[model samples]
Target: MNVEDAPEGVEEPQILPLDAWHRARGGRMVPFAGYLMPVQYEGIMAEHLWTRESAGLFDVSHMGQLVFTHDGDIATVVRALESVLPGDVAGLGDGRMRYSLLLNEEGGILDDLMVTRRGSEIYMVVNGATKYDDIGHLLDALPDDVTMNLQDEQALLAVQGPKAVDALARLVPGVEALVFMTAGAFDWNGHALWISRSGYTGEDGFEVSIPAEAAAAFADALCAEPEVKPIGLGARDSLRLEAGLPLYGHDLDPETTPVMADLGFALSKRRREAADFAGAQRILAEREAGPAVKRVGLLVTGRQPVREGASVVAEDGAVIGRVTSGGFAPTLGAAIAMAYVPAELAAPGSGVRLVQRGKVHEATVAAMPFVPHRYVRASASPQTPSKAGA
Candidate 1:
């Protein structure tokens, strides 16, 4: 969901394995995260709606896929990872994944990532823009016995929506057995694939990591399903925004802490009690006293969307906070945004005044995921689906 233009004097944007495939489907190419990727094909609105109702395929090969191994036992690698990340790495069951934050010594967030315990090796997926820095950080923090492998020859694809499982299960055969936050290795056309029942979109989904050479064929096979259609980055952004998922460079940064970003769930209870991991002291202290600013969702009163960089202002026009992500949520049929505001004003239904381009807009602090999440968790009751954040 993080899209940006290449700055002046930057190197040429690289192409994904499916670059030609996207163009063949009329995908509009654009620069994002140092890569030439599709922003849209048919259209953002139609693609978004289709995804919510049926299935949408997204090309997310730009994300960094990493595998960590150790000469000794897996515990050695887990300890090394737990030292830098604020998650209980050792407690993760096999094939289970956890969302975590990479924090600086001063408690600022470097990035948010997903870590999965896969067999003897640990697998991780990081934001593309910060993957290199993350690799460097891990190498520096890890002991010499632990080895990190950057999976450069892999392509990541996500199939998301209510019917994603129906479409994906037909190809992979056993992927439907994977519950949320679980992954497994499977064979497709003789190519090994690591498939996870997880995705950026709030809907039930699967992310498939396949060999680069086989990516195009795999994509074609998925799209061949009547319930599936290829989606672009434009719809990806709006879907995540509606789901209340934070974008790294925009909603999170080096200056933002987990508590300030409303991501305390990333800080495991055991890790918090043990006070191990980077910035534990500061993070735990903030958890006790509360952060000065808290991230909250906003429901704009009008149809026009308020974009990022809009200022949250007081009645007297003094800037109080800033909007990180904003857009018109097609599912909710309303303009929504995520912003950091004073702790006292973080409660739901709190009045907020935003100014964009010198025009004042009225909004109210609201609960996140303007649209409800529909994850198929193992523990979800049949009467009510899970509303858990992705």
Candidate 2:
């Protein structure tokens, strides 16, 4: 199938480093993020449940791995990035990562990304579909002093689930010590690796960045463990949805801001206090008075699942919002959805209507994460010095 937000013209789907491995494992490939990625293996439901019960390996190599550097100190690089993103990149400690957004001049979201301070340099992971656009935006917006390097030769993997830690710990020792949102450099069979204690799935897991040439071997080694299985995009979407996480181009876009998306947390305390970031005036005002509309979760009354672009209507048949993402929540045993609605109508338990397949389904404003997030929250600590390695 064609991918969402694919370029206008028809183009050949690119192959990932693990493309062959995915097909070898019975993966049903589909076009996504401009690549022929595995959408499912075994089945979506089975893989979804297996990931929640055991470790599920995911091939996220399609994501853009980027490195930002400057001839000056880390502080200079941090300040430059802070102008574009609302996150506290300047105060971010070494080995620590923060979920942040690239905002437009009007405070609208351009893309969501993970920012990690790797020694004097900064590393970033952006969504696959938006990486090219993001790179161009950075080059144009950032100062001439900052340099951007896209790691095209690198590949990414995610080992997510309750058993994820144990499965990965067995491969690279010491990774177990890294708390949530923390990362460190390590060596696996002499191949340098960058592992982060974080994932899109709410479950405790790690995202490992390795050389493209070693990606297949590394993935094979992880799957060798009895607790681990290779999961595909179908399960990955379900898992993230259950975790209440939002997907770019679906739940988020350039038209939405952090406050409107219920992602104000990405605006760090320091940034909020200083109000020094891009679109600060508009974002801060919305924070205090609330946005005209907000993103919220919905629980459909029946077994039928709603889908993206579904109209969210009111009791009087007035369209109030639109479903950004929705589906049968296997874990919840019910249909759930994420949508944007007027702030007053976004309260939990508020009644709404979901129009899917030309049928209006009863729905209620529900709390997100249809499932609970199992992130291993880190304890309070002082900043540590940077370590040198991949």
Name the top TM-score candidate.
Answer: 1
Report the lDDT tens digits of candidate 2 across residue range 79-142.
8889788988987899998889999978999999999999998999999888878877887778
lDDT of 1 by residue, 255-366 (tens): 9999999999899899988998788888889999999999999999999999999999998999999999999999989999999999999999999999999999999999
Q: Tell me the spans in candidate 2 whose CA falls farther than 4 Å from its real position.
A: 1-10, 380-390
Question: Which residue pairs in model 1 clash with each other?
Answer: none
lDDT of 1: 0.90
- lDDT, candidate 2, residue 11? 61
TM-scores of all models? 0.96, 0.94
Question: In model 2, what lDDT does residue 360 have?
Answer: 89
